[model samples]
Target: MFSRAFSNPYISKWIVQGAGIIWFLGTFGLLMYYGVGQAVAIVDALIFALFFIFGVNIIDQTFNFYVPSGRNNSMLLIFPLLFSLVASYFHFQLLRWIFDEESLYLVFLREVFLLRWAVLGMAEILVALLALAVSKLEEQKEIKNREVMMHELSREAELSQLRQQLQPHFLFNSLNSISALTISQPQKAREMVLQLSDFLRGTMEKDHQQWVSLEEELTYLKMYLDIEHVRFGHRLEVVFDVTDEVKQLRLPQLLIQPLLENAIKHGLYGITEDVRIILRAYKEQNYLMVQIENPFDPEVAAPKGTGFGLSSVGRRLFLLFGRKDLLESKAVESVFTVILKIPQHK
Candidate 1:
């Protein structure tokens, strides 16, 4: 409780000011004792301390309005010097009036007039510099806070744009597939339309969600795959190799669908035979590791399309985790594989 009270700026300032006033009174009291008697010395010290405190407050208030900088910093010394001279003059006059009959004490005061001015000047100048430093620190803190807020706003805008782009890209492809099946297989086209509606509804619901359990993501992926299955018929096959333990872990919402879409596009395009795409997930220490495997022919050129899915996912991962190595891909022999690692937060 005491530490917390001192942490407050107003309380700390008053404490320091009180200590300084006590120090000034003690020092002047001892000095005045050499010539004046005890009662007169106490009066003299009290009056001088009042003038000293007033000079310090004036300096503090001046700096509050305009802190000197660059060429004008010389004002810092000049103001304190002038204030000390003025205060010392008034203090000496007041003492002389109060102790008109004390000739010896008057002589003592005249002798130490310059010394008192010098001491007060130094104290006031120290206070001015401290106030200037505090002002500069407050300015710098505000600037830093503004910069962080702007960066956060920029990041959120980019993430929203990336999410919006994915929906239209997948929608166009689904609409094209449905158009192709309308004449020859009207029933399948109607089924795909319904599946597409459900998938889009789920996507809209999860658009604002940043994270979800692995099981929830898998359910959303199943909806997406249902639409794809209608378009591909028996040629495309996807196998899930996820355990119950892994399904309880969490990942970014809709993060896995793009990887699966990439796998299907590369694995099935221009291929006449049936293809199997496998997705596996498990826990590896502090991270949840997910890997997708698909077979692709090197000799056959894949269909040309915008590679936005993988790139957007990579960008999203970097924005979320500040790590570029979280998403990776490689091809070995005829098998293509993509690996994604998500940090598990307890």
Candidate 2:
């Protein structure tokens, strides 16, 4: 009956806060019953007040540290009983010495023993309540962790589906370029096919890894860009600024391709002006700083697509690193930028 409602930190803290009121009532109750002039009674009550606080904090840690289910409840009862017995005995002995009328010995013994039994009963109920609260918290924690795991797995599956969708779209575009080249320039058509094959080989080789070294992913992306450059000619240009120390650090595969595609498609959609894609990668303290920015065309609205590419990267970053604060996208006038910050793993 005591285990479920007040098991988590929110409820547990509330219970402890309420215990402050309980402690006040118990201390004042004992003081009024025993009389304030009885110094031993006052001191004994104070000791028990301290005991309540200590018992609560210690039991919270012990139960939550995972003492094994079978042995846990036994330890819970044993600790409070032993502590109370010793405290009650001291309380009784101190009173006996103070009164010193030997005839009252029997009466004192009689009353003290009865009081000890009552104290034990109260202690039992309190300990039961506390242990129950701790048990509930542990169960709730396990449930929350499980929920997080399931969410991450679902996101991973969605990402896989998105990658599949993208591959075909990317391939179809490149194939059209090769088809055009087959008639206009036969020699260049053969070279484009070789590059296409190499690019597909790289993509197929990475079917398992969600992440790869920056250098490795960059190499693959450059192959794809080479094919696009051949098709677009002077219409597209790419500039890469990467630090030597961070090239070997691992990052999500194809992290920059979507951003590059967004830059060219939207940044140059309406006008015949040449579009430039600049990608920057460097280390800022302990973080991997990646920025994909372009001077977007002010005259054109956004392009037509699924509208999930940038958001997919944002969501993936948040899920992978547990960083609700890291991924950011900003745009003003002619410039649109996506900033990706992930913990650098060497």
Candidate 3:
């Protein structure tokens, strides 16, 4: 609490000003003690302290308008020296007028004139340097804040672009399927159209959301899978093995869809037999872990297309969590597996 109080600029400014006043009072009092006696010494100290405070105030206010930089910083010393000379002259004249009859005290004041002027000059220079440092610090803080904002905006834009790109990619494929089914299977194509409409509506709603519960995301994934089921029919099969404890945990919205899409594209495409894709989710230590497994025949050449789904998902994970190790994929014994780790923040 005490440290916080002192860190406040208003509190610190007043504390410094108070200390300066006390220093002027004590120094003047000691200087006048032996020559002028206690009664006159007190009065002399008070008057000189008032004049010193006024001079300090003038220096502070001047720096508020203009502070020297680069080659001009020599003005730090020059300004104080000039202010001290002027302040000392006025103080000396006032003291002489107030104590014209005290010859001993007048001699003492003259003797100490140079010392008082030097002390005031040094104090002013110190204050000027402090002001310059504060200005530079504020500038640096503002620049850092601006850089952070720009980075956030860039990340958000890229995420939006990825979302937009995924939608059209799926839409074009669905449209092709619908075109194929128009003459042969009109009823199933119409059903797929309705499912597509619902899935696109959910996507629009989730675009403004950053995170969603695992249960909600699974429901959204079910909608997407329904549309895919219409396209591939019984050849594509998906299994979910999610634990109840992890259903309430949150992950990035639409994070799982791309992985599932990739699995189906590689697993079922060009394969006549039924292919099974498994998705498992559970909590492990401080992370919500999810794993997807699918089988592919290595002997057959995979579909020729750009691999945007996996790359975009990986980029999104890195941007959100600042970790490259969150998403991992490996192919072993013709079985392709993807493991994703989401850190749980309490």
Candidate 4:
């Protein structure tokens, strides 16, 4: 009842403010006609202003925001008019006594008492309704703003979790390669072990960072591919085609690793024919473009994929860039390609 009625702040404040303003104007007008002291009138208006600011307006907000039960809402519309009449009566009586004049007494006895206070109090109620309307509008705006902020924050948290998932996922996959090679090609496996150490150290070294330069990502990619090369030898081939200019651009850390993992994951498996994976990067228009291409066995690849790497990269990109249109995956001949467009950020 009371809770539902004052459901809007603007309405409530406007009501209180309207009451205060009427009290203000009527008090001001009466004193002007009666020629009362300026100091007293000013003090009176200030007192009412502070009263409504802290008293009615601020207090009403508690009901509106927190205890918005249907039982309590009717108080919003009920109390203001009641308070206004009481306040008006006291104000008129006070002015009558302070002026101490027969003409002032007669003014109230005839016309002023019947018309001035009642008309002015209604004016205050209307103003209060308007105030509530405006307050509700502003409140809604603030709510929407807060929702947008929360969604962005949630996405960032998800990306952070996914980002952490990459390092261990890559390590587990690479370790398997090294484990397989260790038993068969002992000397090559020894070289891979050292590369694995450097690769893991480099990846884990930048643990707290959310972003890194293109050069740093390239270094990590090269180390990873080097270890894979040592594992597959001639069975695996990788080429980097990147321009000099875009090498220093910034990107979310650990981005390329998952894409590379995807490339390798889809590029090889159950094939007597050799496979070549090409990774290329360049600047096109306003975006930094990266493409990963790999050959052989698409039908068996998706089953092993578990749908994590490239799609996760796409989600992470949207969480960061606010755009999901930046990624593309296509198959041409026996090769599968993952193309990414990262917007240039300052």
Which predicted model would earn the best lDDT?
1
**Model 4: CA > 4 A from native:** 1-69, 107-111, 185-191, 271-275, 297-303, 321-324
Judging by lDDT, tell me the better candidate of 1 and 4. 1
**Candidate closer to the true structure by lDDT (higher is better), 1 or 2:** 1
Off by over 4 Å in 1: 1-7, 18-22, 29-36, 46-66, 70-74, 93-101
Could you tell me every candidate's TM-score relative to the true structure?
0.86, 0.56, 0.89, 0.73
Reference-based lDDT, each prediction:
0.85, 0.70, 0.83, 0.70
Best of the candidates, TM-score:
3
Pairs of residues at least 3 apart in sequence or in different chains that clash in candidate 3: none
Per-residue lDDT of candidate 2, residues 172-240 (tens digit): 767888899999987778888898899888888987888888898788879988888778778888889
Model 3 agreement with the true structure over 1-346: per-residue lDDT tens digits:
1112245778856765696679667865686655567767777777667666666666666656775788999988898889888888888898889889989889988988998789778877776677667756666877999999999999989888887888898889889999998889999899999999999998898788888899999999999999999988998889999989999999988888888888998898667799999999999999999899998877878777635677888998899988899999988988989999998899
Per-residue alpha-carbon lDDT of candidate 1 for residues 194-263, written as tens digits (9 for 90 to 100)? 9999999989988788889999999999999999999998998999999999888998887899889989
Compute the lDDT of residue 194 as modeled in candidate 2: 90
What's the lDDT for candidate 2?
0.70
Model 4 per-residue lDDT tens digits across residues 1-346: 1233567856755666676776677666665576645765665455444444443554345435643226745544555556665655665566556555656454643455545546545654554555465556666878999999999899878987888788788778777877888788888878988988998888778967887878888988888889888867798888889888989887778888888877776776756667788889888887788898887575653546445887888888887878879888888777788888888766
State in Å the error of residue 238, model 2. 0.9
